[model samples]
Target: MAVVSAEPVKAMKEGQILVTGAAGFIGFHVAQHLLSSGREVVGLDSVNNYYDPSLKQARIDVLKQQPKFSFVKADLANRETTKSLFAKHRFPAVIHLAAQAGVRYSLENPHAYADANIEGFLNVLEGCRHHGCGHLLFASSSSVYGANTRLPFSVQDNVDHPISLYAASKKANELMAHAYSHLYRIPCTGLRFFTVYGPWGRPDMAIFIFAKAILEGKPIRLFNHGNMRRDFTYVDDVVEAIARLIDRPPQGNPAWSGDNPDPASSAAPWKIYNIGNNRPEELEHVVALLEKEFGRPAIKEMLPMQPGDVLATYADIEDLARDVGFRPATTIEDGIARFSKWFREYQN
Candidate 1:
């Protein structure tokens, strides 16, 4: 369920909520959802040319219309700038979403991951630590599951063997957050997001790329020879999950034991949740849905498995449901149809 209809589980904390990467796909939706619920939001973005600057600007332009929304354009990698941002705002809760995303891109440009994901994340932690944030919720990735072959990846799964630099960076964020939470007592929650797709999605993502190719009568590349599967969670579902979790910060488990430590929770105010569809859908099936929605046939190009890419990703959202009382429920078919409608209008 979207936040538009669902009542907020907890009232937002006083003062403006700081949402980094507000121009980005998921961040934009998160910011929008918060603003819709009568909350003041400070949206920040570097507006880099990761995909298309215009698309990011378009998202910002929409957010600008909200009287309660304020926009800031700054690079998170810059320590002084990020510090200044936190000092200026003194945000009660910080939703750190800005990062150098994409597993494949990390292979070509390893430095970017270090700059944005690692260095930038550290800056966020320092800010939250010194500035007194009530809760720090940051985006992690299912890619952190690396070599683990477990179906329906759980938050408690050991994620030490990340295959890609991007995944490693995300894992690093989780560790960094946990340490801060343990040492400084800042409440932190890490969200391991699966394949997030919807309106205003990244141009580099499979659904966006395939949508363009299918409409233009071009062949769509299916990595892993069209056999890959993903827990495709819609953007609204993700925003809903985030909206619900904002007020409910983690209170460290008293039962947590160092002798048999649980990877998902800590003795400190730290926790992790896998926010995904909890149902894996095949790559072929996703394309079929797109074709059905757009009323077009796709030309297929099967390719061997790419480096730093997993064969499948399924989310074990039991922890999220138990704790937050929510799980991503949008089916791939429904998500594709909604995406196709938006793509048509956006393309025009």
Candidate 2:
């Protein structure tokens, strides 16, 4: 629900936790953080061709170093495989993050979104529902705010129109989760993450693209006439928020009413929150920060707005702050510096 409430929670001391997309940017960070804190983690990833398999492998390499970490290589879309994986490890908590992620890509290949986001998520939800999963935290995206002219997007917003299939698929995930929560009384939490950037971030995102272009002395595309804003939440802050959330499973909202119901709340044990920096940054300003961090100017190439791209994204993380006692406080200067360092290192 959108209602603000909380309680302190200790980390899971025993029982295996399933982390889908463990080879991904945020998923890798989340898995490592859990293993480092003495939690046993079982990672599942399909190792698809959406990006370089090498990068995914590198993340797996890091995770495999932890003694408490185990992994299975398989696609989540296959119901049999997903069921087998769940049966093998009766995880008390499941963090579902694996999916075909990318907006522009979705235009060319809509089937991937349907297969991965929709079908895969349905499989994950079923696994949780049947396995007695205590908590299910899944990744949604700020892109779900497609076509909405809202500033500082809140979880309470009505998101009906999604410009891209990717956004639509993610939106479908939220709806599917809510239905599962209502029908099965499963505890589900959806986090609509803003522009998350840091070390090991996805190569498809603007931060990675801009940084690579600027460093290579190539022209970086400036869409929407360089008039764009995004709330770039750092990876560390996002991981911290997720860590805090895993232990606090949602309870049915007592104040929920059917007469004039809110989309963000339910009488069932379901919840959603915006995980973001709570601040917006202009496109020009972001480029400038990269230029400063890299000590080189980006060769600018102005262009019209992309088909599925939004003009801006601003997250109102009030519920996140109130519930987790945590907020995305990473400054651009520091965040960019960290990213720049990682980029340079990864290249070498």
TM-scores, each model vs. reference: 0.96, 0.97
Q: Write the per-residue lDDT of candidate 1 for residues 188-290, one digit (tens) a residue.
A: 9899999999999999999999999999999999997899999999999999999888988887888888898899998898989998999999999989998
lDDT of each: 0.91, 0.89
What TM-score does prediction 2 earn? 0.97
Residue 237 error, candidate 2, Å: 0.8
Clashing pairs in 1: none
RMSD of 2: 1.5
- Model 1 is weakest, by summed lDDT over 10 consecutive residues, at 1-10
- Scanning candidate 2 in windows of ten residues, the lowest lDDT window is 3-12
Error of 1 at 86 (Å): 1.0
lDDT, residue 296, candidate 1: 92
